[model samples]
Target chain A: MGVTSRGFAVLFLAGFAAQPAFAYKIFVSNEKSNDVTVLDGDTLEVIDTFEVGQRPRGITVANDGNHLLVAVGDDDTVEVYDTETYERLHTLPSGPDPELFVLHPSGNPLYIANEDDNLVTVVDLENRSMIAEIPVGVEPEGMGVSPDGSVIVNTSETTNMAHFIDTESHEIVANVLVDQRPRFAEFKSDGSEVWVSSEIGGTVSVIDPATHEIKHKIEFDIPGLRPEAIQPVGVRITEDMETAFVALGPANRVAVVDPETYEVLDYLLVGQRVWQLGFSPDESLLFSTNGVSNDISVIDVEDREVTKSVQVGEFPWGVVTTPD
Target chain B: MMPARFLLAAAFAVAAGGAAAQEAARLDPDWPCVQRKVPTLTPAAIWTGPAIEEAGDWRDDEEVRELVNLLSQRRVPQDEAEATIESFAEGLPAEERSARLTLLFAGLFDTMNAERSEIIEGIERYARHQKALVETIREQKETVEVSPVGTGSEAEQQLFWNLRIFEERRQSLPYICEVPRLVEQRLFALGRAIGTVVSE
Candidate 1:
């Protein structure tokens, strides 16, 4: 084989070899209990549970994977905790009522959705200052930053629009009107399209990233489920961009879809009121936060079976794992 | 010199108004029920309600009969649910039963009023916060030339749209008229539950 072909073979093998020996931990923010539950991702056992703040909801690991950032909406601050020691670190200037946020790829800035204030607060993590407060539609919540770090998109719950905010300039470049109660926004790994899930609308709008126009909408129907029950919330797309998963809020099922063809493949039954989802570092497992049941259903990604359900804190809202 | 029919009609109207007033008056003013619904906000808001659901677990189209039926099935075994309800109703005195009803009516009334209060209060708070955000945006507009893709006017427009929604909801509060019917239905359910409790 030529040198280019040999290099491709070596890189592919390296990727497969790196899948094993993945050490990571999962952190869940409990909205009612005002605490976070940290778990061992491999064993699915609780490592520790500690008080973070009041009404903790959105959570994610820091870009460096050293700290866990918990968006405490009631406390109006994003609390940071050390990943190694699980100790309380400093807090960041998250705008009023920070519900959800996305970290820029470069990792210094945080874009937060201030639901009550109707603004997207951009914070500079290193300087710890409010860099820019970009006004969005009513009840800004789900945030998705582009893989290239050039732009980030936010979904407004009340205004029902997917707003494209330019990262460098901190301005909303485009607004695409969506259905009622748009809850979460997810972009493909390739940055080709942005998928926005509307909770009440019960549809996912796939928008063209370049033109800010909706190319298509993916709809769902379950055999015995009522139409209202199929409320879509969280969305996740595989790295290969071949598959996508959407959490149907009250339906207690995750709709697995083919991203390429936009086909609904199957619905995996999860716990009650599945609101958010997280994938294991290696993509072998997916964890879902069932708000009503107060437990998380762990789905084996390959087998697509709900292997186990871990009882967590009351009304769990957000889930994230340390970076691989 | 007024006709008997006119006097009767006047009496009926007065009775109706009194009944309406009593519906919302179930909770004593001091009973922590009439207190502000927002619950003191932190000087800085920490976290907020789910963006998908501003009023958690509250559906605008909720019906009283549906709720009562659901609550009737809770924790109580289906076979024994009616008997359990009947026994509880039988144990209470007639006056006590009436009092429970009053409290329930108060609860239902407070519920609607609380919802109304939340919308009003939330809008007020939104307005206050929106002002601050607009000020920040204005400063950014002056200092930093906005992105090549968007202008500062777009951000302001979003805020304007949000405020308009709040104002619309505020004005339509009285017309939505969700509370009075809700109170009547809750009482209806309470009566049914009582009947079940006292039944064999």
Candidate 2:
């Protein structure tokens, strides 16, 4: 017993010493609470919750890792905050009801999906000015930028299409019809494929980037559960393109799929109404924001299991991790 | 109009009891909305002016019944509704104004709560119907795939049509989800509009 305690002390000291290398923070936007819950990425413990504007739905860490950008939908603005102090820096103008957004690979311009106005608002992060408002289909909610920063896609819930826009031109290049209520679009790291998740259609359509045609529709079936319960929403593919994780909203599970085969590998049962997901900087862990349950589920990526569930604020919607 | 706005704000505060309370109160698993699944709202949730129990039979009063019907319909704008309430109370005797307005609120609350409950039930039914159709669509697709139905064949065409119709129905869910909140807001506004006319 004495040796065990001494060994644990040394390991704790080692962890504290190595904090600089792996020190990161996970920011979760709670929609109802209108605040962001910040957690220590290493310990997976809540560090703080900072209040923001009304209806804070989408949140992301700026590429610089020094600032956090949150889409306050009701306020019709994207709020910027200091990452370390959780202080409000300023607000960027967005179109009405900005639900989700994505930063360019170069990290200068940010693309926002204005659901109410059916437009994608692009803003220059450095200057904090509106760059352009690219019109898309009805109720644009999901925003995705390609790895090369050439193309950005916005999924419209009512129109049921994935509208791809060229970043440089800020114009619609292609409108590929997917299943109904496509809530999210995720591009593979190599820019070879784009995966869009349809919430009501209950499938993820894999579109070929070059051909702009859907190559596969990945459907999930969990035994004893009705098909409608398996509503696909947020999707994320690993950097290596070996695996993909799709958040099955209201099904209370996350489906793991083989990116190459488009086959369901496993389902990790999470909290109630899991809508969004994020990955740790090293991709060692995946966190799911369970809106109804008001908690975030920590998934061990290597082990393919939920390791822990941490309670958060009300109606947690979006999540992003700092790269530091 | 000022009092109506205040009541509307109060109603929202009551409804925004956080997601944890919502989860605890929600019993229906198939509810598919971002808003809390509140089956019904009690008078205490929004009313703050007077005791509703002593309001008496609001339906028996012809004037109160007519006003209730008009106020319950969300088509009437809140400002217009408030003006109507103010004019009605101004015509009433000063001693009877508070009692009459309280009766008005009781009538509005009862009628709106019932409407909201009905809408919630309808939403649940819609979800159940969608679930059944999803199964049917899956089976139909499998049959079309297994049979010798060529592309553009009748069986394949039927499957395509069903899928399209299914999606069209699914698209209405978001709009339908807004109805309950709309009813609550209107009720709160009208209730508070009457409150403004009553003597403290």
Candidate 3:
């Protein structure tokens, strides 16, 4: 049973295509160190670290589950890398200062936020060129793709608005103003509501996608701390669409909230200045990247407690894990 | 050039659609402003800042918290307010009947000049205080960004830029010009009252 080069390639691709339900590898984008740190998702231990662009912030596992898409702001390009080999594949036409992005379900067109330029650059994955540069609000950071892939939302920090763009037309159909300094946007698995976290407002605004208006707000109140310190930044809803975890920027806590009630259930204390979050493919374990502490805290989603902390590179800004 | 036009068009469209977010009040609208909305400081809390039992975060620095409590009122402090306007309100009625009208007039002019000085001094202090607030926020920001526990080197370049922008004279200086006019209006009203009393 000798495996030739072609047969090995097939086997390699099959391993990626059919990701085992239990296998998980977490990738963290470190901004200050200009690298990406890979971790064992189960043990929460540092597996490897590879040099990326000048300042890598936003990272995402490609929908195909074989590549990692990282928005290198300093380089003004979204560099793709082979998930297994950890080698740079190519760069996307992400315009200037690409910070965060969301890929289409088909993984053909990529929607990226260019923070400095105040535009969302849509690049065609097949052509490796920009398809359309959608003009968004100032300092765009968060990108959310709908479950049905019909529309995508981009939240602007300084603008303090969540903009909904029609995927087909690639135009902003509506803009809904939320609280101050909106940093991240997330849609429920069922596509019923979209949650946007306002860093300065210290609250998560639950907006109705159909109405394009804020339905309710989820606020945090930590014991012995002022409300101002509860800066909500990263938000992720669970696969079952029952729970949501929001990363508090300076508060160093992740608030577990009920999606239906918009009530904060509990605050899970993690490392310092928790910036972004990731989850395993099976949605069992959740990972949080603490930039100030330079570590990743793994939490059992069911238990809602931080089980382990894995030290990584400097100032980790984003995190993504292998797909199921 | 195209981007400029696109930006203008987008602004106009957003304005027309009534979907633009409310623009925050800035000393200078042209420059980027720092986020200052503290959640615990409700409208009622701002109205009665000193009465707040526990302003949790600001408690670390008693002096800064005190200053913040004062600024939350959105006006000059009591001592400065008194020296500028309140003294004039009560100064004239205290003069003796034997006090010459001419002397009283001279004193009134002197008092106005003194009030002017105090208002100018208030502007300087206010600038210094606001600059300090920027520094405090920068230090807090660096705590999570590039402080001892975090990565990077000594000194924060973003904070330096933040301080410069926050303290830019063009922004807050206009407010300084307005304070004097408002204080003078108060003094002028008091002077009129003094004149009427003498006429009677």
TM-score for each model: 0.61, 0.63, 0.60
Query: How does chain B score by TM in each prediction?
Result: 0.30, 0.81, 0.32
Instruction: Rank candidates, lDDT, best first.
Output: 2, 1, 3
Two-chain DockQ for each candidate model: 0.02, 0.02, 0.01
Interface RMSD of each: 17.0, 14.9, 16.9
- Candidate 1's docking class is incorrect
Q: Candidate 3: misplaced stretches above 4 Å?
A: A1-22, B1-200
Candidate 1 lDDT over residue span B1-200, tens digit each: 23323333443343233443444334422111122223221100111111212222323324433433443333545336445445545666875554442333233334534444554454445434534544553454445433433334665445344434434443454443433323222333333343233222
Model 2 in CAPRI terms: which quality?
incorrect
- Per TM-score, the best of the predicted structures is 2
Tens-digit per-residue lDDT, B44-162, candidate 3:
21011122223233335444344333322325553363343333334445453213322333343344445656765665565556546544644546463444433344444444444
Candidate 3's error at B129, in angstroms?
19
Q: Give the Å shift of residue A309 in candidate 1.
A: 0.9
- CA lDDT, every model vs. true structure: 0.71, 0.84, 0.71
